[model samples]
Target: MRVGSRRAPSAPFPGLLSSAQFAALAAEYRRACGFEICACDSDGKLRRGGAERPSEGRSVSDLRKHAVSEALRWGEPSVLSDGIEGVLWAIPVCQNQKLLGGLVVTVTRLRRPSKAGALDQRVVSACRVLLELGTRYNLVNAPLLSERRETARREQEKAEALHLMKEGTFDTIRSIYLREEPALIAAIRRGERSAARHAINRVLTAIYMLGQSRIELLKSLALELVVTMTRTAVQAGGNPENILGLNYQSLSRLADISDQEDLAGWLCRMLESLIDAIESNSRLPGSSQLARAVKYVEEHLAEALPREEVARAAGLSPSHFSHLMKARMGCTFTQLLTRMRLERARSLLVHTDAELAHVAAACGFTDQSYFTRVFRKTHRLTPSEFRRAKRPIRNASAPKSQTSARLYKPGAAVRC
Candidate 1:
């Protein structure tokens, strides 16, 4: 763009491009060139442009370079008919020095340039100048070459950004999954339902974060992340049989992000790894013992206890429990605790006459106010309201209870 250039020009070039003008212009040019078929190739596809056709694609690319070199050097084309026979001549159809494809022309019949034909070469030379001005600088046409380069650059930028984001995000997910394996396993052993869910959810949240970014990441990378997350969830004491356990569908939702099969395969591998981890962690020493303790805490949800207290009762140190949790489940002990309390509170609020404060206490909240706050934050609602909405009225018919369906669905599910 120049100092006086506007984003768009006001007027149109009629004879140059409009059908009415183009027909007349073509006729005039034909008369000037002794009635020959004239063709144009703004994209360098010479064969596609001309009716008789010379060659196209890679062949056109080669011919174009030759044409540009010869025309710039010796000035003017050789022959128009047997275009291949000519000493190629092509001048750039440029606005400034930016090469916008090439301007090419040839005589209808293969006319050899004799020593006496210097005068006709001047006519061809003049035509090239007209083309340069009419097509490149006119108000009617798009800057095709500039547009092409711009579009290519934009696509390249998107791909590069997606690659970088995907790598960083998945690294975080893997770390979170591996770090809390032991705690998750221990919780599952102890039969602590909430504990297992906490680990599962952390992984699920990570997946959601990646999914939320969704700026068109490499589909393969996204798919792999989803698969890896799903497998990990299932491994960490999660039940794949329960959609709430593995949440494979949630992982699969990211498939549209990438078309690369390698990512998809990697996702598949990750899922398998999670399944393997879960099966093996369950057989560890004191797993059943831990499971009992976990179940006690789960059934008696009124105690808002920490992972360390829970681990101590199960005869394991918090560190050991944490390791077992992550190995068995794919998330941490603290995460499991938070999920359990929240889950219990959600149930009491929805299904019982327990007030918000009482519900919070039953779910392990020491203070009713704090329980309400956490409940609001987790469910995006006040405790009383969540209960009111979730509870089926005595007179109204409703679908199956959310508590039964959602609380124990397979795969991982998130509260927030």
Candidate 2:
């Protein structure tokens, strides 16, 4: 037989095998082997076959495409298995050392042993005849086949990129905010850095997904989250001025950040600082009872704080609670309450323009005069002088310091 003809095969076999030719070959194979057969070109497109037509509710096309891919990948005949559809023999069609397309033959798993052996022999014979026809038609050298393969590869890459981008959504942000925001606050309150970090990371990841890796947009979203966190920490008892101040300074730097990694690092640092402030204002861990009593006094400082009532709230008798407070905190209930009130008064004086009477009432001192006396004694400066000085208050427990000498004695009856 003449081989390597440059003239394209007529009609159904223009440059490659036609549908009629493929069908005839498939029918002949199936008649002899009782197996379904299909053919595809180098680009993994189904050309023709007994099983190539799309059936309702069946993925025959996808199976044929996969078979074509397998044949091309291995550059030879091979067996391919599908979970739901059983096995396929992917036979590559090559001529003059060049690939043209593939032949895919379906094998039923239920066939008996003797029948299967006979079918295998028929399949081998059909593949040999197909290869010979491919060489004679010069189908393997067709330029269209190479173009189709390149086009398929490009389409696959584009599909993968789209899939990645579609994975994120606005709903993810809402879910993460609901789940992680509270956890982040609780972790900060407990002073658990690792837990706080984990919560923040989850939030960041959610935000990252929402924006699909857009660096500028992610930074903007992160800054907004930081603002919300700062407010939450303040509401949880962190100093408003301190928390807000830190937030402002951090935001100044954060606004300039455009890199994703830099943005995450800056946000983490900001969160850690907010957590530190909250931890500082929080009651000491392991002193639950003392913390409760102290919290009660702090909250009720604007009213009368009988030691009995405070101790009861802490689940301890007045005397026992007082002893525990002194041992663990180095201050009696009355002294601690006084110290907390003084601290509040100082904060109001320095941070606000409230009148001395209002400040005294707010700090739990009933009489303005008594409030002045105690404030001056503890801080060594009158409220007006302290506010005007704009200086931080000295620690009341500092030994023999000017402020310590002037400290108000706890439990001494004041006009309040």
Q: What lDDT does the true structure give each of the candidates? A: 0.50, 0.64
Best by lDDT: 2
Clashes of each: 47, 1
What local lDDT score does residue 154 receive in model 2, on the 0 to 100 scale?
A: 49
lDDT of 1 by residue, 212-235 (tens): 644455443344445545554555
Off by over 4 Å in 2: 1-175, 283-286, 289-416
Query: For candidate 2, lDDT tens digit of each residue in 1-416?
Result: 78886864333334456656766666666554456666666655666544444434546556656666654554334455455445566655655446556776764453334654354333444444444444454544334445555555545544543454466433644455665677676666555566677677667766776676788878778877887788778866688878888987887897688788898899889988887787567654437777676667755788767787787666454666777777787766667778878877876775566899999988887468778888888889888998888744333334434343343333332221
Global lDDT of model 2: 0.64
Q: What is the TM-score (0 to 1) of candidate 2?
A: 0.31
By TM-score, who's the top model here? 2
In candidate 2 the C-alpha lDDT for residue 173 amounts to 49
The alpha-carbon root-mean-square deviation between model 2 and the true structure, to one decimal in Å, is: 34.0
lDDT of 1: 0.50
The alpha-carbon deviation from the true structure for residue 405 of candidate 1, after best TM-score superposition, in angstroms, is: 13
